[model samples]
Target chain A: MTQVALMNQVVEWVNEAADQIREKLKSPIMVEEKSNRHDLVTNVDKETEAFLVEKIRTNYPDDHILGEEGLGDNLSDTKGRIWVIDPIDGTLNFVKQQENFCIMIGIFEDNVPILGFIYDVVKDEFAYGGAKTGVFLNSQSVNQVENVCLRDGLIGVNGAMFCHNTFNVRDIAIEAVGVRMLGCAGLDFLNVIRGKQNGYISNLAPWDFAAGVALSEPLGLKCSKFDGSPYDILGERQYFLVATQKTYEEIANY
Target chain B: MTQVALMNQVVEWVNEAADQIREKLKSPIMVEEKSNRHDLVTNVDKETEAFLVEKIRTNYPDDHILGEEGLGDNLSDTKGRIWVIDPIDGTLNFVKQQENFCIMIGIFEDNVPILGFIYDVVKDEFAYGGAKTGVFLNSQSVNQVENVCLRDGLIGVNGAMFCHNTFNVRDIAIEAVGVRMLGCAGLDFLNVIRGKQNGYISNLAPWDFAAGVALSEPLGLKCSKFDGSPYDILGERQYFLVATQKTYEEIANY
Candidate 1:
């Protein structure tokens, strides 16, 4: 199969995995602490990651995987094709509210993203993309969203970004018409795709953003470090995806 | 009828009115600009408020009404039995997303809140209360929620609150595990009742908060000014409704 064909297959596989997870999510799952008591992981997270890894290994034996919850192979490099998975993004939201969580998967070829998918299980929506195929929501291709200005736009940031006096996020927030921190990076990425927000910034791991970056680039989003540098996949960094050219320029200057 | 009976009657009336609005919401209504281009008011909002006002007038001839979009009486005082209404809280969300908005109504008897109701029309759920009766969701009375610490709690605030540098909201948000701004005060209030959030703070109109205060008070929530004082009905003050007694103290100190 061509790389494009492989990306499509990956999308299908992730969709199936999402459906499986959603079915079991009807009942409460066991929750455990991760980095802190506030940082939660559930049985669903581990089970879903294991399920996805098993399927990928069966289908694409050569491709490596990196996933949260340590279900996937330990990766030395992003060489060749690698699948980065976050079985349950927004675990806190999932455990507490049973909504706003999503399944995320991103395919990268030689450290460059080739495909991204974020599925909102509760809403039954999926956002997917790669530069070659452009961005899509479900089966429909999305329009190239216009870049809006920061003063007239909605921006998303992490709660910590806005607080703690670091990065001066408060000043940045003041310039936008609105600021939203939905507690889910995948959901926030979807909002950017829908034009509900001009951009978002957060401290994201590779699994949290790999698929989002794949979807965003082709949709005309300017995804980069807070200082407007290229995204480094191996390094966990605070980055933003701006919707409009004007907003990107404004934020960069700010 | 006793005061409790009267409040029940009002609740029933509001529920029916909410149902009417929800049914019509199935069809796309014309959305127009209000205050500014970004601010929207839909035909559904006007129609719903009108429907509610007509019901209140027919049922309680002596009661005064205050409603968003000027569908009800022009009110200068909270004297007597006053019904404060926001036919659609989160009007922008209703116009765009069609999910996060809600119908909010608060009945104040002689400047004191006697009843409050917030109906999530799409979700077919409700949170309601009055001074004489405790808060309830659907048919069950909500238990007095335990207090949570800010570091372990979720909080909801208006998006603009974070951006505007008002009351140092950005700093406050960093102290919580996560923060959310879902665009509807009513929904935020419900989350607090569900224990999904420790508390919420917003600069809201009376209609936006009247019903919420009613529901939150009986749920052991500490609803007060940003400075931790009693909330004023007529003033558009920054208010906080903390989930736990401990959370309230922690935030107050922060």
Candidate 2:
């Protein structure tokens, strides 16, 4: 099968994984602390990751995987076909609110992102596409986001920006119409894709952004390091911002 | 009619007003800047407020009304039955996202809050009731929110907290698991009422919080000034915090 054909199937696989999560939510949740009390991992996240890994190993055995929940193979490089998966992107949101969580998957071919899928499990809005298929929101092709400037748009900022006052985020809030934090990167990315938010910026890991970058590339949006550098999609926790070209330029100058 | 019957009727009125908004959403949305670019008002807000006032006056003309959009009577005292209306709380969310906005109403009897309604218009989740009828989520009686301490629970902070770091909010984020900002008080208040969040704090005007204060009262949550003093609900730009009993005390001490 062609790469696009394979990715069409990958979207279905993502939906199946979302089903597993919704099923797990029916029972009492069992949570375990990951690095500390602030960081958390739950059984559903592990289970979902296992499900995706199993699907990939069965269908595309040669593909390497880098996943958050340790259900995938350890890989030294993003060579050949690498699938970066965040089975449950916002576990804290899942455990606490049972909302604002999503499943994100980005499949790369020889270090270039070819397909991306982000399923907002609760709202049932799936954003999927690639360089070949173009970005889609629930099978509908996504149009170009409006070029709203900083003063006219809402921006998403993580806790660090507020707590540390980084990038003058406090003043940015005043200069911009407002700022919001949804506690989930996928949702923030989705908002930017939908033109509801001008941009989303965070110090996030590879899996947290690969799918978003893939989806955004075809929509005429800019996905780059916070300082307007090229996105190092394979790198670990890095400052990232996805936004419209105008907003990106404005923020870059600011 | 008894107070319960009157409140039930008020809930119906709230629903009627919500239906009006849902209908108005089909047409083109008209928005006007209020005071500044950061603040906004939409045609839906004025229309919803007019609809509710018409309903109230048609049924209970003796009652005075205080509303956010300046569509109601001006009363010196909260004597007699008074209705507080925020036709579109989070107008920015309404105009930008159309998902997070809500309609809020609080009914007071001789300066005492007796009934409250917060309808997440798009989600169709209607939260209403108060001290006499008990708090409710879509006609279902809501139980008490868990008494999670400030450290263990998620909290909601508004833009001012981040901009000014007031109440040591920057450090407060470190003390709690994390924080979320929805840009909509009704939604944040709904999260707390659903036990998804421990509390919400903001510098707000009278109409911004009157309904939330009424809805939270019966849920065993404390509604107070951020300093833990009694809430002066009718005041403008007062610091308000609503939370579970334990969380409230901890925030007060912190």
Candidate 3:
């Protein structure tokens, strides 16, 4: 199938799977801790990951999967088609607030992002993109917003990013018009796409960045490492940057 | 009327007004810049403020009104019964995202908070409190959540508080379980009442804190200055503190 057709199929599947998972979460779901007490996981995450893995394996037999809940393939190489999945991004937000979380999936071919989808289950909004089709919100094509300067922009940042004696994120925050932290990576990415925020930065894993990178790139945004270098899909970093063309240029220079 | 009867009446009025505002916002509303390009105000905010002001004037002619849109009284004195109002607490959020904003009103007699109301227009949820009545959510009485240590508690902070390097705010954030900035003081107060956050700190104006203090104080949460002293209702200070009983003590000592 063509890349556009494939992405359309993936979007439909994602919506269906997300709806099923959300239904199951109507009642209190079992939660587990990962890494630390702050990092959490719910049964819905594992269930959704399993469901998506099964569907992807059945539909695209040769595609490899990298999922958050350890329910997918652990491939060292990014050869061929690979699906990076975060069944429930913002697990803490989900477990605590029962909102502001989402399902994220990104497809890569030979280390190049081919397609990305971020689905907000509570709001039922989908932000998707692919190299061939550009960016879209729930099937409607959306153009890149006008380039906004830092002084006129709203930025999304993780809490840790703004702390003292760290990477000096506070200095960067002061330059922006305002800063917000919603505690949900998928929602944060959607805010950037919708022009609610001019840019977003976070300490993210591959699952967090994969779908965001795909959606952001097609909108003429600059997605890079904190130091304005190309992102490495295999390496975890303390910071990721997504910004409008004007803000990106300013930040890159700063 | 008794204080309970009067509060119930005010709650009904606020809910109806909020409903009207929400309906008007459903259609496209004109947006304009305020102090800067990043600071936005929508026609909904002005209309909502006018609606509430007119209602208060017609219903309770004796009460003095203090509102954000410059539509209310301009007196500096805090004599007599005063009604402090913010038609829409998060104007930027309302204009940009159309969610996470609220209608807030605080009624004080002789500078003592007697009634407070915060309505989440999108969710149709109301949170209120006062000396006569304890904090409540959607009419259900709610108890103050037990105090937990900062290391085990979530903190809601204005992103600027940590980023400006103004008051050693970053160090305080690092000592909490997690830090969140939702851009709306009213909604952040709701989270605190629900125990989603242990406390929040911000440099808020009178309208912003008036309703929140009404809801917070009777619930046994500490709303004070950064030094753990009482907050001045009319003065704009650098910082304000709100925390659970135990968390307040721990934070004050720290």
Candidate 4:
């Protein structure tokens, strides 16, 4: 399939998945703890992941898949066409506020991002595109963020990391104009892509940052490890930062 | 006029003011510094305040008014019927994000809250109520927040205050489940009113917290000074905190 056609198909499936998630919210939600009380998953998360996995398997049988809910194929290396899915990026907010959570998917060819989608279900905004086509929010074309200094822009932060002063995050926040935390990686990325925030910093798994990096790269954003190393597509939980190029340099140096 | 009638009138005027502000946002916004770079004001703020003040004076000329833009009546005492207005509660957000800013108005009769209205212009949600009438978000009734412990609920903190460790806010953030900062007092209050967040803490003037307190009182929220003293309705810039009773007690004691 052509890239545009494939993107359209993916968008349709995501809208369907979002519809199911919304319908499910009308009923009771059963939640379970993953690693701790802070790390949570709901029945809706599992169902959404399963539904998406089934669709991918039937349509793209040869593709490799990795999902947050572990319902997809597990691979040892980044090879061939691969899909990374985070069914619900903000499970805590999903269970608590039911509004800020998002569904994210990233398509990669040999570990290079080809296309990506981040669906903010409640807000009904789909941020999608990759390097070749450029980024977009729904039908509106998005531009690269303004290159800003650390002291001139708002930055999204992981609350726990900031509170713990992880990697001196507190100092970075102090240097920025302000800080905001939505507890959802997808929404944080959305803010940065829309130029509402200059950057976002957090400790994230591959699924948490995959789609974000795909959408951000085309907008001149810099995404890397806390120590300024390039990202490992299949890496585990690690300190991650994505920001406007200037802001990234300032934070890394600070 | 009856209390309900007054509320309806205020709601109509606020909606009109919001319309004007939205129209103005489409043009170039003229921003100016207040106290520092962090403290901002804009032409829209002044225009919105003037618009609302005109509506109030033409209708209820007997009532005194206090406004953030200083376009309203000035008085030494909180006597008689008075209207308090913050044309744009989060001017910084208004100038930066344009999505989180809000219009707020409060009605006081003889130093007691009679009605309040907080309009999130972009979301088009109006959280309005008072002591005699229960709070409502648009048309839906809003209930009191759950009395969760500090460690179990999300709390909103002022970014500057939290970073500076003002009143040991960093320690308080460490004790909560997590922290969120939206850089908008009105939106922060709306989150607490809707039970999405347990509490919010910041330094605010009378215009900043006036409408929020009126709506919160009907929903059984506890609003007080950082020292746990009762709020002074006409107070100036001070440390303010609002939350569920349990969360209030926990944060105050801690």
Q: All candidates' lDDT scores? A: 0.79, 0.85, 0.82, 0.87
Clashing pairs in 1: A147-A244, A173-B163, A174-B163, B147-B244, B198-B243
lDDT of 4 by residue, A113-203 (tens): 9888999999888999888877788878888878877788888998878877888999998888778888899999998888888999999
**TM-score between model 4 and native:** 0.97
lDDT value, candidate 3, whole model:
0.82
- Candidate topping lDDT: 4
Q: All models, DockQ values? A: 0.43, 0.78, 0.54, 0.68
Tell how far residue A224 is off in model 2, in angstroms: 1.0
Weakest ten-residue segment in model 2 chain B by summed lDDT? B228-237
Candidate 4 regions exceeding 4 Å error are none
Q: What are the RMSDs of all candidates, in order?
A: 3.6, 1.5, 3.0, 1.5
TM-score of chain A of each: 0.94, 0.95, 0.95, 0.98
Candidate 3, A1-254: lDDT as tens digits: 98888988888889888888778877878988888888888889988999899999999999898888887786878799989999999887777667778899989999999899999988788989776878889879878766787767678887776664245566666687778888888998898877788888788888998898888888777888878777767666447888888887776666
What candidate 1 gets wrong by more than 4 Å, as runs, is A2-16, A19-29, A73-77, A129-141, A164-168, B1-44, B74-79, B95-98, B121-125, B129-143, B158-172
User: Which segments of candidate 3 are over 4 A away from where they belong?
Assistant: A2-5, A23-29, A164-168, B2-5, B8-44, B74-79, B122-124, B129-146, B165-167
lDDT (10s digit) by residue, model 2, range B110-183: 88888888999998889988888888898788998888888888889987786677988766667778799889
